[model samples]
Target chain A: MLSPGATIGVLGAGQLARMLALAAARLGFKTHVFAPSADEPAFDVCAARTIAAYDDPDALDAFARAVDVVTYEFENVPAATAEFLDARRPVRPNPRALALTQDRLVEKEFVQGLGVETAPFADVPDAGALARAVAKLGRPSILKTRRLGYDGKGQVAIRGGGDLGALFRALGGAPCILEGFIDFVKEVSVVAARGVDGEFHAYDISENQHENHILAETRAPAAILPETAVRAKEIARRIAEAEDYVGVLAVELFLVKSGRSERLIVNEIAPRVHNSGHWTLDGALTSQFEQHVRAIAGWPLGSTARLGRVTMRNLIGDDAERWPEIAAEDGACLHLYGKREIRAGRKMGHVTRIELE
Target chain B: MLSPGATIGVLGAGQLARMLALAAARLGFKTHVFAPSADEPAFDVCAARTIAAYDDPDALDAFARAVDVVTYEFENVPAATAEFLDARRPVRPNPRALALTQDRLVEKEFVQGLGVETAPFADVPDAGALARAVAKLGRPSILKTRRLGYDGKGQVAIRGGGDLGALFRALGGAPCILEGFIDFVKEVSVVAARGVDGEFHAYDISENQHENHILAETRAPAAILPETAVRAKEIARRIAEAEDYVGVLAVELFLVKSGRSERLIVNEIAPRVHNSGHWTLDGALTSQFEQHVRAIAGWPLGSTARLGRVTMRNLIGDDAERWPEIAAEDGACLHLYGKREIRAGRKMGHVTRIELE
Candidate 1:
């Protein structure tokens, strides 16, 4: 088990890594962020940082030797990088969890194989396979790259009269998955954690809203049927147990309402802290970031009780310009990622509010 | 007004500066700590730090030129240091406030001059004056050095048959104040802030318990009479206005319960964040550290609403060894100063817990 003064090596240096570093610091652990960018947001607050590329062997070796454990901020860490670090130090949510979530087909298959419901999906390798998959999944499906897709990127929506051959060629004939669209009443997720002792704790379900395919808001204690929420928690538990997950995991679900009945379909599993869990910063007994640190350190799981009715909103782009106003407001907790520039569609910060009823 | 990208120069490099830097970073501001200690705790988290004595003019000039404003973690900043920086950048809480609080006699005089009640005090310069003052004030008076005293140091209790000359000689024979003891019920403090725009916000009073003259625990929404708490707030407001203070200030009070009626006597003012206000980190809508940063930056004061019944306990020396257990607790928020060693009576970290009713 990693102790309080141990070092944590983070693979990426984005906002997630920054928040994780801050959380780790609060737990008496130091963070060493290794990223190619010179001024990644995470570097600003970390105890140590190496401005080196992921493939830089010397930097990776030094980082691994310095830290007691390794973790990645995002799922796109190269397989070779993970293997290299795993040889030197413990890397978790483990390389297997990363490998499973890095690809679309593998993730869906793994979830479904665990007796969990997922959206119907078919692999399309070429034009002929695309046509076959189109016929099998119907025209109103999304053709997403089997790898490297995030925030609605690297995916194209197919409707009636959309050319299958042209669409396949447009995506450069990369291996892809065709997912049949589900009429989701609401998008919800369970941000849960598995401790080193295999104890699982899940926060209240969070309902998410996406604007321009980017998360806009997340509300905890999601206004979903009680049974559906329970089922969502169970799905997360089974997935964590099946994977032997040792850190925070987020399972996104599509809630379908039918005649006063609710059904949940597994959308995806994120093997790291989820944006929807941001509300935990102020609205829950323990934040998801802190939970992730504890789980990775082989510590006991903290309480998952929601403190009050909580709402979290992403401050995308210029929305962060209202920080002065937000900071002045009562009960508004504003967190700004120290990003130099605020580009369009970039998440600059977030605000969390807890309302006591 | 300093903007987000501006720099803040801090005088002290202790845990308070470490916390202030962290708070400033959250608002996208960089911090530059000027301290003589090479192993200053704040150096690990700040963007820049200068290692030189406060009297080093060259280092002070460079530090003052590097930041947009100046603030200190403690009130003992040499008057020359404050003046040197004040000529270059704005200094919040102003140097006069520091001068007033740095000496026990000056602080007592200032409070009484404002028509605020304080423990009856008399200037004691030598053995003769000490005897005379004790005779006038009666037994059980506190003889404290006028300057450079903290955490039970530089003070001696005078009871019947005590060695007055030896006690006076032991205290370095510096200027001192002899304060008559108050038969009080509790020690509480009001932490409040005044923004540049003249807006004032105060967190609820916190009941403080001291061990060896160092703060041990603080409970927010102090168990005191409602009118007495209001009077404490009013006294703080009056002091802030009198000083034209533009940042957080803490006023310690002695609550004397005589019959069903309760009255308050001013103890001393901390021209910066007080240890008693540490509970605000997790117990209030806005933490005292963040509020200080905001007030110093000429921004809006955040809400001081209490989140719940909250308690903060300082972890001194070996107490920090319990960090692992504290981290595992459900709602406990533990914060450790990145100090290297845990010397006896040294404050290494603190933990804040908010209890929901």
Candidate 2:
């Protein structure tokens, strides 16, 4: 087990890394954030920061030698970077998790292999194969890049009367997956952690809302059936066990309810802290950030007890300009990412309101 | 009012400043820590740090220019240093608070002037005055240095038939004050904040216990009568108003219960965050450190609502080595200062346990 003073090296220095560094500091672990950007948000609060490309061998070697373990804020960490760090020091959640989640087709196949229900998916290697997959899956499905997709990027809807060839060319002829859409009543996620000792703990399910394919809000307890919540957590646990994951991860699921029957379809798995889990910062006994640190450090997992009915809203772009009003609101906890420029669709900060019952 | 991204300059880089900087980061303010030690705890988690003597004019000028406001972690900030920073930028709780609390005689006199009860005190500038004060206050009184006394340092007890001359010489013939000792049933403190807009808020009273004259533990709500708690808060409010203080301050009081009636004596006032308020970090809706940052930033004061029954124990010296066991505890929140060496009685970290009702 890593001692209290051991340093954890974090890849990607965005808001996720910033919050992770803050949580690590609270747990007495120093954080060294390694990012390509000199003005990344996490640098303000970390013990050390290395500004270099992910594939920079010298920088990666020095960062690996300086930290006891390595973790990343984003799932799309370069395969080579993860392998390099893993050889020098333990890279938590493992490179296997990165390889699995980075590709859409691979992630869906892995979830299906675990006996978890996922949307109908078929890999399209080229435009001809895309036409075959489109014939098989039908219009209204989603054509998403197999790799390097985030925040609704690198994906397009296959609506009726659209040219499949044009759409395929628009995605730059990249390998893609056509997923048959599910009419989900709500989108819920299970944010959970698994320790090296094989201990598992999951927070209460969070119901999420997306605006323009960017997460806008999340409410904990999810307003779902207790059994559905249990099943969702079980799916997360199974995924963590199968991956031998050793940090906080989130499993997004589509909840479809009709005529007193409920079904869950596995949507995606985030191998790092999810924006939906942000509500746990104010509403749970132990936050997911702190839980990830604890898991990576080989410490015992903390209680995932929910403290209240909580809602977290992402302050995108100009939404953060109202921080003064939010901070003045009773029971509202405001967190601002130290980003100087505010552009539309950029996540500037977040605010969480918790109502104790 | 200072905006979210404004910088907060903190004096002293011990655990208090470390925590203050952490809180400032949470509120979206960057912190620049100024201290004489290169290895101070706050250096690990600040945006900028200047390692120089308090009176270094060039460093102080640069630090003042870099930050929007200045605050300190300790009360003994040299009056000259406070004055220098105050001239360049606003210093919260104001320099008058530093001058008042740094001297025991002045603090007691000021409290008394506000019609608040304090232990009867008399200034003893010399041996003859010490004898006269002892005669007036009687035996078993305490003679403490007028300036720079902390953690039971620079003080002696005047008992029945002891050498007053020796005790006087032991204190290096410094300016002292003789205070009549009160036979109190308990020691309690009110940790409170006054915003720049003159708004006052106080956390629930905390009952404290000392070991070797250093704070050992603190429990919130203090197991005191409701009226006593109200009166204690009122005293704190009065003191803050009298001093025109801004930022969090702590008022330590002696509670003496006689039959159905209770009396409170102002013992001392801490111009910065107090050890007694550490429980608020996990047990209150808003932590003392965060509250101090809000006050100093000219922002709205956060709620002081207690979340649960809370107990905080200081991990002194070797006590922090049991961090592994502490981290494994079900509901304990552990915080360790990044101090390299641990000496006996030196605070290394703290653990807080909250029992929800």
Candidate 3:
């Protein structure tokens, strides 16, 4: 295990990296943040920061030399950057995990290979393939870019008749996957961490809500049955073990109910700290950020016991304008990301409220 | 109230300042740290740092210009430094609090003036004064410098007979205060905050244990009588109001029990976040650092509800060497200040374990 005073290099300078850096600091570990943006949120709190593009060889080399282990906040970190860092330092959650999750089709296949069920999907590499894929998945399926898609971006919802070639061209003819829609009662996720020793721990399930395709809120100990929660964690554990993941990974699942029976469907995977787990910051014994730090540092996992039932509401866009009122609200824990510009649908911050069970 | 993106200038670059900066960042505020030392712990996490003597006018002016308001980590911030910043920006807890708490005798008198009980104390300006003060306070009394004393420094205990002149010279014959020893059952403190709008909130009393005059351990919701805890908070509220304090303050008290009756004797006042209250970081709804930031920002105070029965043990010097074992210990929340050198009596880190009540 890396010693307490070891330096950690993080490859993103957003709020997730910001909280990860803060958590690393609490463990006597200093963090160096590397991102293209000069004034990202994590820059304000990290010990050192490099403002360079993902493909900058010199910056990546320096970052590797400066840290004992390299980790990242988002899955979209360029493949070449991860490979470069992996060659020098230990890149946690490994480059393979990144490659698997970076492409939606590859990720779905990987899960299916492990005997886990996923939303029915088909590969669409061209406009001609889009028609066949849509026919296989049926109408009302989602055509999403296989690579570099996040927060409901690079997606085209196929409902009624439209120009299939126009839709494929709209996404720049990028490799895509058509995912069949599921009649899920709720969307839930399991944020789990795996140690270098192969030990795995998962937090309680989080029920997620979305607005405009962006995460709106998350309630933890998600109102799912106990058996379903256990099954969801088992699936996440299996995925982590299969990937040889050595840090936090989140598995999003669709909680579907048919009559009186309920089951979980594997939806997607996030290779780092997930927004659905933000409730753990205030509602769990050990926060997901701290857990990720520990796992990447090769330290033992901490307790994932929930403190209570909690709800986390994301403050998006102009929603952050109510921060003053939120601060005044009793028992409401407010967090605001230091983002200067408020663009539409941008996540500005979050507030969590916990009710002890 | 200062807006979320405002920059807060913290005057001392220590663990307290580092924690305050982290908390400020969580609320979308930035922090600039000012300290004389170049490699202080707080510098690693602060948005900016100014390494210069506290009395350097140019550095002080530049720092003031860079921040929205000024607050500090310790009570012994030089009087001139506080005054200089006061002239340029709004200084939380005000300069008067520094003037009052910097002198032990003055603080005792202020507590007494507010109809609160305090240990009997006498001022010693010279050898003659020392003799008279020792006679009035009696043997086993502690003679501490009136200015710049902390963590048992600049203190001499008078037990039995000794050369009075030598004792005076031992302390450099500087102004001092002789406090009569109290036969106390325990040492407890109320970590409280006062908002700019005069709103007051206090956390549950923390029972403190000292090793070599440095805080060794603290357990919240101290074992004192319920009424004693309420009375202790009342005393702190009275003191904060008298000082018109904005930001967190700590009131250390000696819980004395006699004939089944319990009462508290005021021991000392810390105008900033106190070491005894560090457990609030994970054991309370809102940490003391966040409370200080909220109060100084003119924001409403957060809930001070304790999470459970918690114990915090300071990892002094080499005690931090057991971090690996502590990491494996379930539910032990470790907080290590990023200090490289570990010296005897230096507070290197701490571990907190919480048990839900």
Candidate 4:
């Protein structure tokens, strides 16, 4: 196991990486963040940092030599980058897990192969294929690029009387998947971790809300049946075991009401700590970031007991300007990512408010 | 008021400074640490650092230029260094507070002037003064150097008989304060913060236990009468107001049982975060580190609500070697200071265990 004082190399320099670096520091580990950005939020807290492209082998070599283990905040990290680091130092969650989750089509098939339910989907390689898939899946289906999609990007909806050629052109004619939409009553996610010893622990489920296709709010101990919550966590555990994952992974699911019974459909899989689990930072005995660090370091998993009923709100765009107000609010825990520029729809920070049980 | 993106200048690069830097980053503030040590714990998480002795004017000038406000983790910051920085930028908790607390005799006088009770103390500038003070205060007294003493250093306990001249010589002939033993039943401390607007907030009192004159353990909601606790907070507020404090300060008190009534005698004041308040990191809504940052930045103080019953244990020397076991303990929060060498009597890390109420 990597001991305290060991340097951890994180691949991204976004807020997720920032929080991970802080959590690692709490455990006495120094983090070295590697990203191309000259000054990202994560750089402020890390012990060392490298401003270099992911494909630069020389930079990767230096980073590998400096850190005891390598991990990433985002799953879209290049496969070649992970492979190069793995050759010298251990890359946590492994390259195989990254490959499986980076592409939407592969992730869905992997979940289905494990006997988990998913929406009806078809591959659309070109305009002609899109036409056929649309015919099969019916109108009002979402056509999303199989790779490099996040925050409702690289996607378009095929609604009544839309030209297949234009629709395919809108997505740049990239390889894609067309899936029928489910009228889900609620969207929930299970954030879980797996250790090197194969022990698994999962935080309570978080029911999520999206605004402009970006995560806006999350409430833990989601208002769902206990059995449904159990099933959600079980699906996350099965996926982690199948991937042989050794870090925190989040599985987002759509819960639909069917004939007075509840059904959960696996929507997507995130190979890193997801935003839905941010509430765990304040409301759980162990935060998801710390759990990820422990799992990657080959340590035992910590308790996942809930500390309170939690509500987390993301401060997108100008929302973070209210930091003063939020800071004054009684019992409010405000976390602001050090992003100077205020762009529209950008996630600048978040606040977690908890009601003790 | 310092904006979220402003840089905070922290003096002394120890674990207390390390924690303050982390908390500042959470609020989107960058920290520039100034210290003589090259690899102190605070350097691991700060945006920039200066490694120069406190007496170096050039280093102080650069640090002042880089940060919006200046603060220190320890009260021993030299007078000239603080004045140098205060000329260029604001020095928080003010230099007067540091100067007062640095000298035990001066701090006791200040506390007593506010109608707060303190143990009888006499200044000893020479061997002759020591004899007179001993005769008045009686036996079993503590003779501590007036300045630059910590963790039992620079102090000697006097018994029934001893050579007065030898005792003064043993202390290097430095000015001293001889305090009469009060026979305190318990040691409790109040860690609180005051804002620029004269607003004050205090955490629940913590009962402290010391080993070899170093803080070893702390229990929050210290087993004291409710009225005594309220009175303790009142005494702390009076002290902070009298000092015009603008940051976190810890007031150490001696709880002496006075025949069915408990009386608190102000023992000392630390003009920075204290070890006894470390439990707030995991057991309270606002940690002392975070509270200090807010007060120094001119931001509103956060809620001081306690999460549960908390017990904090300091990991001195080899105590940190049990990190693996503590990390695996259910609901235990372990924090290591990342000190490379585990020398005896050195503070290595700490752990907080909470029983939720």
Question: Against the unseen true structure, what C-alpha lDDT does each candidate score?
Answer: 0.88, 0.93, 0.93, 0.93
lDDT of 3 by residue, A145-203 (tens): 99988898999999889999999888888989999989899999999999999989999
The per-prediction tally of clashing pairs is 0, 0, 0, 0
Cα RMSD (angstroms) for every candidate in the order listed: 1.5, 1.0, 0.9, 0.8
Regions of model 3 farther than 4 Å from truth? none
> For model 4, how does the per-residue alpha-carbon lDDT over B1-357 read when each residue is reduced to its tens digit?
788999999999999999999999999999999999897999999999999999998888988989999999999999889888888999998999999999999998988888899999998999999999999999999999999999999999999888988999999999999999999999999999999999999999999999988999999989999989999999989988888889999999999997889999998899999999999999998899999999999999988999999999999988989999998898899899888889889999999999999
Q: How displaced is residue A68 in candidate 2, in Å?
A: 1.0
Off by over 4 Å in 1: none
DockQ of 2: 0.74
Q: How accurate is candidate 3 locally (lDDT)?
A: 0.93
Task: Tell me the interface RMSD of model 4, in angstroms.
Answer: 0.8
lDDT per residue for candidate 4 within A1-357, as digits (tens), equals: 899999989999999999999999999999999999877999999999999999999999999999999999999999999999999999999999999999889988999999999998998888889988988989888999999999999999988997889989999889999998788998999999999999999999999999999999999989999999999999999999999999999999999998878899999999999899999988987899999999999989888988899999999999988888898898999999999999999999999999998
Off by over 4 Å in 2: none
**What is the per-residue lDDT of model 1 for residues B151-244, given as tens digits with 9 covering 90 to 100?**
8999999988968999998899898899999998889999999999889989999999988889999998899888888899999999999889
Q: Report model 3's TM-score to 2 decimal places.
A: 0.99
The DockQ of each candidate is 0.57, 0.74, 0.85, 0.84
- Which candidate, 1 or 3, has the higher lDDT? 3
lDDT of 3 by residue, B262-352 (tens): 9999999999999998999999999999999999999999999999999999999999888889999999998999899989999998999
Chain A TM-score of model 1 comes to: 0.98
